[model samples]
Target: MRLRWPVALLVTLLVVVLGTLMGSRTPAEAAKKITIKDSMGRTVRVPCPPQRIVEVNGDVAELICALGDAGKIVGASSYTLQDKFFTSRLKKAQDVGKSFTPSVEKILALKPDVVFGYGKFLKPEIIAQLERAGVPVVLLDCYKIKTMAEDIRTLGVILNRQKEAAAYIAYFEKYRKLFADRVKKIPVNRRPRVYLEQYTDYTLSGPGSGGAELLDGVGARNIGAGLRVPYPKISPEWLLAQNPDVIIKACGSSITSGYGEKPDAMAKKRAEMMRRPGWSRIAAVRQGKVYMLSSEIFTGPRAIVGMAYMAKWLYPQLFKDVNPAAIHKEMLKKFHGLELKGAYVYP
Candidate 1:
């Protein structure tokens, strides 16, 4: 009670200092939590650099692994393991179930901080259950070519990997432009007529579809452009009448037996198409312009590879120097930290 003035002043300053210290937090502390808007237009509060995550979609899992956060994945869809690329990288992640029907029990047991899922495929009830259990799920739609860059960026933001996201976008756009810039110079009259066999024979990709978009990007005319549906079945008669200049059969993903293990699988598929009734009279069959295309490339971030190959097939004179296989190797090495070798597309 009889303390000196200096001592009293010192004690008051100590109290003020303690209060200020208690009120403030470091940048790291503030960065722990972040809110983001996913592709579904729903606001989600998630942990930045989430420690544990579950991936319901293989493509999303692949993208996350490519962004250098593979360690964060605690669980993944069962189909992810089927893809050689994902299987090699996501060896640590437990298979929860199919992407569209993930097991809620396994997911809850994993106690993931967040789950990356498909908005269109995953049932709404499952999403609701997860949210009710305090798990935040961010839905992403990567089906369209236009939304891929944005989807990658959104994922990057959520995971606090904006730099990686920007880098990926740059790489993706570079190849996309590599196709568009050269193809745009070709005269309209020279555009080749392309018939795309989608996931099966007779099933074709029409206008306003991912397959059609790839064909359009490479300055090729989709023979099914006039079809009423985005994806329609072309009768054998119709296909023969169209007489496309180039035909690319999409293999894998609903195709019969996934191109098989035979070394001549691609050749066999081509031969089968050529042997189809009335196909011998088709211009594509006669000129040997038919090729086998991987469905994975046309429907994923790797569509640039399909574009390159399609351009080469459609206009060999224009894309004589374009090498899609080399581009594929480069992309795998650069983004995926992988040296995957396979026949993605072939004659």
Candidate 2:
């Protein structure tokens, strides 16, 4: 039996209304917006899975590669290209200029889903340009020991690689706890007075600095902790007075890279440290307790590796079995799928 025209018309209207409602919900369901506050405390709404990304910081980009989302990265900064480990995988990504001063034109050209940058490094105008172009940008603090893990987790969620991110976080926590547990066993009086020399002779990282955070994590004392500034240029006489029990010279822009491999160069540098006016009288020099560290090992997620080395250095007997080199190899191999060879630390 055929339905009446009025009833048929009403049925047709209901069907059309239901279809419209379903169609409207499809886009929202396909890609949901997730609200997250960046390190700068700016509220942001990003797509659940960002397919195209631009990471300005090499360390943050490294973490992205480690989380198995390197394909998602469409643009990167200068440092990422210079990184030997990351060069091959990220070679295809567009060079977005310096870590701090990326080309707004290039970034706009890529039409990335989102852009990640270091809060301290990125310029205000660049961020403003991206924001004005309707490109979502999230600034992060990649180096701080307190928030590094959380930052990784946040990236994992944004990239939809939570499982991979959790694995990395777990590895970081394990090593972090290992150092903390062993260091805690030592008494406060036993903690060594350490001077963290940053690349240059007198430049030091004190309290509130990245080096200070690592030393604190490993339960070591920063002799420069008394300094008012985070990165201060102290006088050689002041260092002589502090008489650090241990001296860790960090290799970075101010110093030549790959010098750690050259025994003669390293010896010359070490000799120079020993010959500093009144340095011979200092406890660290007198006891021959000096070490060379690489900045790469102490930045970003790799800082935990630096802490392990410090723990072993600070208390050899307790962390005798903790091999930082082996851990470094495993982390790079397992997370990054790269077999990198280099000397990051030296006696």
Worst 10-residue lDDT window, candidate 2: 254-263
Clashes of each: 0, 0
- State TM-scores per candidate: 0.83, 0.85
Model 1 TM-score, all chains together: 0.83
Write candidate 2's Cα lDDT for 107-220 as tens digits: 989988789999877999999999999888998777878787888888888878899989998999888887877778677788999999886679998777778888888999
lDDT of 2 at 199: 69
Q: After superposition, how far is residue 157 of candidate 1 from its true place, in Å?
A: 0.5
TM-score of 2: 0.85
lDDT of 1 by residue, 213-295 (tens): 88878888888888888789879998888899988988865442221233266677778778999988989888888888876
Candidate of highest TM-score: 2
Clash-forming residue pairs, model 1: none
